[model samples]
Target: MSENIQKKIEDLREELHQHNYNYYTLDEPTISDFEFDLKLKELQELEKNHPEFYDSNSPTLRVGGEITKNFPTVQHQFRMYSLDNSYDFNDLEDWEKRVQKALNKPVEFVAELKYDGASISILYENGKLKEAVTRGDGFQGDEITPNVKTVSEIPMQLHGDFPDRFFIRGEIYLTRKNFDKINKRREEEGLDPFMNPRNTASGSLKIQDSAEVRKRGLSAVLYQYISSEFPAKTHWELLQKAKSWGFHISEQAKLCKTLDEVKAFITHWDTARHQLGFDIDGIVIKVNDLSQQRSLGYTAKSPRWAMAYKFKAEKVETELEKVTYQVGRTGAITPVANLKPVLLAGTVVKRASLHNEDIIKKLGLHEHDFVFVEKGGEIIPKIVGVNLDKRNPENPEIQYIKTCPECGTELVKIEDQAIHFCPNELHCPPQVVGRMIHYVSRKALNIENLGQETIEQLYREKLVENPADFYALKKEQLLPLERMAEKSAQNIISGIEKSKEIPFEKVLYGIGIKHVGETVAKKLAKNFESIDE
Candidate 1:
């Protein structure tokens, strides 16, 4: 690389790093969108020219950030679990009968609308909110206490004389009013709106900035207390007591005495649930008696005493308009099936992923063919199959692309893997950007203030070409950037310096290796003599 080009790269990383900290951690911005873009563009061009020298911790790999090889295992006080789901009244009745058989007596049931949002465990100690954790893998969750305290519904202090240490299980959700308002504003600003209230609510709660949490209007309603010492006799009674402790309890919860009553309650909500302001994917039916709940116990993944009745999949038939290949950050090219717009599951279903070339060929999917689509897990909807009977006589067989559209590079298929990859590496701008992002992510380098946009900005401005270049940055270099001030530049430098002292495992994960993740990286770190080793 030319001396000037290397110097330019160093200057860019410093500026971008400062911008990332300001926007992501501080929730403040010093630069304009256009200026940031210019910086990111420059960094990407330089990396493309010198692919061999690119560093792993560059700020380009944020989206599609892969899972760490493993998370440090955290065992819970009581087993964290999921709920068994039922769809309609018949299924609900079946569950009720099963519960009756398990209890071997007259069993009273507690019915509540299962909130379609993030599940969290709020910890209270001596009448104060001590910690808030995500129900991550039903074991341990990220400690998001700072962000959780910003939600108004989450009481700072407990109302009742609850035990010194207790856990309240609740679904944190965004209100319909807040959801619509945010979407409307995004639309006005020409930004893609949030898909659903549940996703937005979850994203809002998990954001690093507590100030951002305040603006999102997130709310939580307590459903159950996972306390070992609570003296509550029944599930319904426990919920009622939790309400007295100032938790936002569900108002529609009903205490059912018979299987018939459970069926009736399920049926009532099936029709009336959408009337509520927030989204609810299903209803939960729990054994009312606390003692019975304890006796029935938990399975590997969920509680045996309770089950959730999920709504049926809503599907629609649409024309297979076009199939496009999207290269993921990891360089995997996934085939996305674009469809003629058709309404399904309260939203328009336009495109679905074909997963891989095998799936496309298996379905014999061709452009303009009619296909049935349904939202799986109420999230991504893909083409179930093509109507071969409706195939046009004039149109030809659809062949998958053999090379990446962006770089004209031959796609590589790893042994025993379905996904095709573009081998361009640093030459591919998107992948370069993706790698940079992964390097600076929260769990990796943990540079608190960096974000996706700033990474893109740094790439455009030619400020940083690789992760190692970040270490060579100077504060004076950043002051010339559009929004950067001396103070902000110094903060970025400080964060970058602090990140250098992080464990080698984090640096390894930040590099965006194909199969290596945090857990595997940690294992490697423990065994290896040095980072290079």
Candidate 2:
């Protein structure tokens, strides 16, 4: 009787995995929703009764109940290099010339959509999903296997011929329909809606509850196949093989035999990208021959063979209600344009960087002027120009502020510098808080528990002023603050204590000097034996 039950469980798991592959990866569902749910329910009951037949990759695990407090960082077996970008056809021609010169031969190219989503690397062993990691700093990333497993598009078990062990890199994204649905629910519940699909998808992978990740309705599309011995000779063939093995490879990927064909592919997609269900910022072009790619080699940062062609940024016009200033850590005052909320690209734009006083003057910005807003590189919002025809005639010309907004001190503009500086570096609230925040940043001391809010609280209560003051903090002092519990307060102290073991270069960078950046700090550390030197 037990043997019969075990066989039934195994059969159900296989059947459900096939149904998932058919629905998500193939885009062709063999079973109806009602029928699939009935089978899933049956499997859940069987699995619940027989603990001995538990399988980690079983389709039942798709509902996701695992809670991960901390995602452990793991090094990639192969370095995940970023692609060099090409904004125009001229740039692509130059890149092609360089590649041809290096290889000394003709090469076919593979053109794939540059999906604007979080990059992920997943490992498979013996046709079963093993681990999934994010693309962090190229060398290492956080392991979020349980959260990734909840994505139905990623198969737990391979169907066809598969490698014994290998890693496949791809993108994890949320569809446009789901993104709207999520934001609609959030708006109804009186909560702040997500800014964009890319950020929302990335944030979902780090959520503590796997069940919550499933609710986010995430999807995956595998593109690149990595292994010690590739199954195919060309990049295009490898993608085809991956698709056959139950991976959700993009059907839109094309192979171009010449530069003209590649250009045509870009032209077609440049307009058609808006029609896609998910967001894509550009097109990724790569040399098809695997051997030629190996011979071309790579630069320090990115592969020499692959290049990304970014689309022109979408621009929109809105009313510039007013201009505000922000104080940086170095006392530089940056002008910001507060605009009437307008939708640019996929996200809503409420404010844009005016950069400095020079930019405001160049735009001839005035009170209640209509201005053009666009994402600089599909990333940061910037005011490009003013719609002068729509400008109000009676409005006053925008003037640069002479006094520091926070400290009420006279501002100074250095010769040859476009920015106005707040000379009151010592007592300015923003500068002081910015310095402390910079000190505990990831690249510097890497203090985990201490965040921007807690630092502001510490400053408000007069408990700390400088980075050095963090070392002298007591548990009792932190406990008195709002939302500070016994465990959280101890964790903050422990984090500060661990920061003492940071390297000399990081310590130098954390000191918050005006001109000393990470690269300069490393050079200084190499020359000087100690901090005093």
Candidate 3:
């Protein structure tokens, strides 16, 4: 209740807010990082002692992103739309012509980098963040506000925002630095490294634990202001206004007066885009005039006013060390190429998918052959061709894997599928262990303490055989297992107890059924009243 403390609190809030605005938006900060940190720490201490003085706008709210058990899907205020794609400049010219024909005049365009990450919609009600939504099916999305808050780049509370309702659209991306670090951590933990940043970013948002999402150190950038209570006249003006509101805005945006200028912009960044920290597949060209965009309207799937000028997949030559086959939970065998660790796109490439024996044979893939690899969809690395010039004629002809890699059984090829299948589903160690791992994965039963290694050990000892056996584990049984301490056993028991209360859909997913994913499981669970039926 002291006037001096209140004054100091108010002053610090204003100071920190202004500094953040300067640093994030304006790119000019009066205070150094340490000075700003000290002020923020002081304000946090004061707010801790006097909770009444704390407000939503306080900088401290940015760090403590909440944890939630699940993310409920929410309907978007505005139906999110994708942009029509263009692979070449001719397509861009044709698109520009369409815009001109629609508007009866030449159109100006704003060309910006198209980030290869999850598209997110953030709804700010009365200048406060309400929901961080995924672009699920365009009409509806999952509300991942808790996990989104963990991204410090995404401001929890906007600064100098006047909109009563703000519908902000942006990309939630993992930086190359963070992606590498995350993969390193995954490798250290004996987990397969994430294939790409975009998918990882997408998958991370849905994790039940927001704390894990925070540890991923996700980042975002605001490009299209999507919607707001206060409508802007032009795309450039909207971005400028968004910048002033303490949002992370990309500096690569440029307003072009003609199609030629737009082409020049795209041509300029085609090779230079690799310099950026984040993954960008192409440039998004949009009609700068908002009125023109509205008049141009939209197609069934995408906005006619905007076009994503996609770049060709970058390819590099790397020696194929060998081919490795993996057994899926469904017992389908997929061949993978072990490459001589080459750097592709923005990340390192140690291996690439061969897809099937058909691909391997078509490419004439042989041991110690020079192979040309490309990032399929600019996310996954794959061997596209065999460089015959560097291959030795004396090398043995390409011999595809004929038997199951794990089980000593002959692999069978289905009539239509190019993939080989291991028929030893009942006794194959990999199939059983893989199925068990899939059953307890995060999207299924979500058993916390039971990892793939533990599942394999249990399977080896014949302690558990089916999904139902997971629910029947005892403390005595766990006590006999290697590295299973009393506390660890109790935790596993607790985790299993918690998992039992999960909805029917999770149970359906946990059963390791063929052709049933999360969506299918949800549909099945909704259709069937009970499992016995």
Question: Which stretches of candidate 1 lie above 4 Å from their native place?
Answer: 1-85, 93-110, 116-221, 224-238, 255-280, 286-308, 387-393, 446-451, 457-464, 468-505, 520-533
Query: Rank order by lDDT, top first?
Result: 2, 3, 1
lDDT of 2 by residue, 1-533 (tens): 99999999999999999998899788899989999999999999999999999999999999999999899999999999999999999999999999999989989999999998899999999999999999999999999999999998899999899989999999999988988888765533223368788999999999989998999999889999998898989999999899888999998999999989999999998878767898888999999999998998899999998999999888999999888898877788988889999987657898998878889899888999999898743234888888989987999999999999999999999999898999998899988988888888766888887877899899999999999999999999999999999999999999999999999999899888878988899999999978789
- List lDDT for all candidates, in order: 0.74, 0.90, 0.82
Tens digits of lDDT, candidate 1, 209-295: 566667777878889888877667898888877766667778899998886787788778766765778778778888888888888
Superposed Cα deviation of residue 310, candidate 3 (Å):
1.2
Greater-lDDT candidate between 1 and 3 = 3
By summed lDDT, the worst window of 10 consecutive residues in model 1 runs over 61-70
lDDT of 3 at 388: 88
Clashes of each: 43, 0, 0
Task: Candidate 2: give its CA RMSD in angstroms.
Answer: 10.9
Candidate 2 regions off by >4 Å? Answer: 317-368, 375-384, 389-392, 396-533
Model 3 RMSD vs true structure: 6.8
Greater-lDDT candidate between 2 and 3: 2
How much lDDT does candidate 1 score?
Answer: 0.74
